[model samples]
Target: MYKKKYSNKFSVAPMLNYTDQYCRYFYRQLTKKTLLYTEMITSQELLYKNPDNYIRYTSNNQNPIAIQLAGNNINELTKCAMIAYSLGFNEINLNAGCPSKKAQLGGFGACLMLNPILLFNIIRAIYNTVPIPISIKIRLGTHNKNNYQHLYNFIKLVSKKNYCKRFIIHARIANLNGLNTKKNRCIPPLNYKYVYKIKKDFPNLKIILNGGIQNLQEAQKHLKIIDGVMLGRAIYKNPLMLCAVDQKIFSVHSIINKKILLDNMQKYIHYHSLKNIPIIYIFRHMLNIFYGKPQSKKLKQYFIHKIKNYTDITILFQKLSKKFNF
Candidate 1:
């Protein structure tokens, strides 16, 4: 119920195009406790573009949520953090862990892992500007240089500012030169041992593990060793994965059945539909609701062939819900 509790439990990764406001709201509907995150918003986009667009929401999710930022400029980051804080974000997470060419060329992401002082400056400025918690999402190391000490020292330098209280570590090294964003995520092997060592060394630090975690059982296994687990593609592909998260991990039996969940989505779709926003933008996030269940393939076919407008989608959903008894 408290904001601080969110900082300690399971969270969804701040993925671009995957964890936008609509997606966050949908996930929040399934589980109220797991901390949701915004997609990586660059400081430049907020500074040069309309600051309101990136952080805008129809209604805030009931659970605590955080906004992750990608940039190297101290002042811009501070301003962006302040803007996000005003929008009611519970935490501001710095991106020192992404390995995309865009992130590297833009002077943020895993590339910043090598430049601890600059990352420190950016995080410190944001920390001083906002009252909310500051966190850093990072990889173990970058470019095959997996020196365990370097990882330790990186955290030491960034946390020296005393504002960063939480750290989410992706248990893999980022390949800056040879890999693209997709490859960087999959090609690298996961070294959970190093992540465990981090918790062992910084016993006081809140270290959340990311990378290669899919099902609740795996998440529970990691939770035994670290403070939390951050799910990436798995939750996006099968969002209903979070339906059991509250009961299995947090030990609170969630009463969120399919009827209530889809009704909420219907309301959200109608709200956007009134604004003339393309319904597909929101419906695409809901396509996986029937994942791993009976009548799933049939429902997917209906979406592909039958969906067009809000009315069509809603009608089809109602029919499918009745057919599946969901």
Candidate 2:
């Protein structure tokens, strides 16, 4: 368990390819208080492959971060939770909301919503194995199970042991059979009212709402009804939105200096470059750092071109600073 309790009032969703360590590190530069999550890692991958490959990029600076794991087997989930706890993660999040076919085939993700007993057992096993907080990221329901009563009963069953107290409910129903992952995000109508009702009914459980929340103002509005809000694509597309998150959402007064931000990243990239890590791995996550700025497209192109030619990163930053008046 973390020495100090961390707030989940605001968070970035664990996107598969988007929420890698580089991205989480970049987001941390913008806001210190908002909780961060790693992209979902399956239990099988963690068990069979080198766990270090999955977690080596994590830094102590990324404190209060949670590792999202996907699997239905109680023993595997418990072992994964222990591994995450040993690695000093602040929380272990079960990925019950992912609608990807890969997740469906594994008998996890959104499908877990249909098997409340097994889901509850998995949670209980993990809770018993690790002392860190355990959270579940889930949709309201799945396919025909998409009803308030069904959702209510599922929540009622899972929350019985009190092992999992926090549930991050994506307000959309996941269509496991007919929809692709992309369609699952858009085709299903979001029923935020059902989420609000859950909060009203389960006053003791911490409820964080997810899905279609776009900005801080909207997050504040939802906070009026729930414990927190989780944003995914919105933050990935326009990261600058995080520039004001600490001050507006967490009530922590802080100033973001673009120069300082770039300088810190430059140093970080250079250090990694020494270890033979390609700059593209880190730079790709940064193309939007200058978002909303004048001539951002040209800047991104310049970056891509320089990286292709293997230009010195320090020189690239000097050029960027001069060209952009950073």
Candidate 1 RMSD to the correct structure: 2.0
Name the candidate that leads on TM-score.
2
Predicted candidate 2 versus true structure: per-residue lDDT over 215-273, tens digit per residue: 99999999998999999999987888898989999899989887898898898889888
Q: How many pairs of residues collide in model 2?
A: 0
lDDT of 1: 0.83
TM-scores for all candidates: the values are 0.94, 0.96
Model 2 worst lDDT window (10 residues): 51-60
What's model 1's TM-score? 0.94
- Tens digits of lDDT, candidate 1, 196-314: 99999888888999999989999999888899999989999898888888889899978777788778887888887788877677777777877887878887777756566335657
- For model 2 the TM-score comes to 0.96
